[model samples]
Target: MKKKLVMMLLAACVMVAGCGKTAVSDNFQNSDAKEQEEFQIEVESKIEQEKCFLCGDAEDSLMGYYSKKESIGIVHLNSLYVSETRVRDFDDDGNELFQQGGSSTMVNSFGEGYGSVAIHGNPDRGYTNIDVSVSDKDEVDFELLEDRLCQICLDTLADFYEDQINSGDNENNGCSGYCLIDFQTKELHRLSEPYSGYTMGDYYVKYDIWKEGGGSDWHRISVFIAYLPERVASGN
Candidate 1:
């Protein structure tokens, strides 16, 4: 009887050990499967949210142009005439930034034709060149006006950049470096290092509208240009 009891106790211990091992194995397998499922979901979500324009493979492209000339006013009255225009395009996902279109002009403020007022575009940022023109009168002050215009261009470009990044069009893509344009000097500068800061996640995505004028007197211009990531990557 004693021997049989001992044998029964041993068998019970064996069974418990076997059960524990099986439970552990099952738990590990389940955990692995769950992890794989989550990873796949993440990839699929990115793919779905990716913008076609970022890849430059789109059916439609955005284009813009601006021109100003002495339409009906005297040259002196048109002191603030802007005859040049340019457009900057960023990734629909907002990772890439660059300028494309540009314009130029000539102005005469006091019956004396200044050399030429040419607003050149930065090859990278699309910001206009230095307001270059010979001074017809030594006292004609243009610094203030030039400063104001440069500020406008900078503000417009910055707003456009933020809008594209916030649009829920792509994932795993963003402005890697600090991208900036100086309109006053017509310089394009990009950081050698990548951008490191807080970013808006999937749940809090929002759309932004950038405008130049206000109220009923405002004109809506879509300066947002869309291009595929591949094309933009190629620098085309």
Candidate 2:
């Protein structure tokens, strides 16, 4: 009975040792795997930072924004007509008085003005009209704004085109280019093209706006823009 008990005890001891060895081995493997994962993440983050630097980080970009005090409008005229008629007012006793008569002018929030000539009393007849409006405050600085907007637009368009190219959709490829307008000069230039070896893309970021229609109408302007090169680059 004593010898049988001794053999059983030794078997139990061997089982406990085997379990301990397995537990230790598993812990080491888990820790090693965690370290490797952390290292990989660090390496990837560094790569991304490098890419950001190459792509002209936010500091080195031009940006644009809609002027807060400005609005835009569009007008369409089909014909030239004018008429002067006394506007009448009627009281309970069929009385008539003269009201001011000239022309009706529509002013948009941006201070743009539109006037249409009364070709006839009929709305169907088209008339020549003048569309004018105060440009956005940003318009005065349009050259700067344009460059920034174009650059950003190019970057975005590039990404969009690349995605489309990958998906095999290249229908509007010509629209991929960027354009900057100098309101003062009334000049429009392509981002890819350089005037005096200074391409707009090199100086400005991109911005986008959503206008309702092509006709002359006041539009809500939304802008996303960047700054001219890095302030650090400018030493300011």
Candidate 3:
């Protein structure tokens, strides 16, 4: 069952690229520590800028998420929501937590129809990628799927923000370190790492949207999770 979910996510995420790196000439894998560090700094800077755009709904900004050939937008803070789950943190008074397919689900944010969508990420499935071809004929259902995946991604991001506030790592601007998680095939990924900053346990929620005003055009969505850095180090 877990495998099937991951596969579906992978397929949805890839969109046109089909769940693989987007043929980058400067792959981060070959980048050394210094280069990676510099890249991280760049990513962090971009995240802050993008956050500002989201806060004020700046339509002129260019830092948006993407799939193969579609532009994806980060969920505006106003159009985001979260739910709690039974997964206890065990470190903080045994309170329940929100995990993929566990304690939380999506409950509507935008487009006047998407309400309470649920999708799960395999905890064991570290950084993963998927490849599949998508057609425009299913654009209606495509938006629904993209909205749900993005909602999950935003909720995961909200969790990251909460974690930051709890750990005294608070930032007034925006949050970072988020990527999509795919558990189906243990594939090597680079483009999935949207933000170059030092992100912790997070995943990518990808989609393709018409890069137009208000970000309401329908395309596709890709919501994936990144593999832990340690896992990447060991070449898993």
Among these predicted structures, which one has the highest TM-score?
3
Candidate 3 residues 197-231, lDDT tens each? Answer: 33323334232212224643322223333433343
Candidate 1 Cα outliers beyond 4 Å, as residue runs: 1-78, 85-111, 138-236
Clashing residue pairs, backbone N/CA/C < 3 A, model 1: 53-227, 54-228, 54-229, 55-228, 55-229, 56-228, 56-229, 120-129
The lDDT, on a scale of 0 to 1, for candidate 2 is: 0.25
- Assess each prediction's global lDDT (C-alpha) against the native: 0.25, 0.25, 0.27
lDDT of model 3, residue 85: 13
When 1 and 2 are scored with TM-score, the better candidate is 1
Per-residue alpha-carbon lDDT of candidate 1 for residues 11-121, written as tens digits (9 for 90 to 100): 333443446445555455444442111100000111221222111222331211111110101111113332222223234343334443434433333234422233333
* Residue 69, candidate 3: alpha-carbon lDDT: 14
Pick by TM-score: 1 or 3, better one: 3
> In the order shown, what is each candidate's alpha-carbon RMSD?
24.3, 26.1, 20.4
Report the C-alpha lDDT of model 2 over 118-166, residue by residue, as the tens digit.
2111111211122222122212222222233334333443443343233
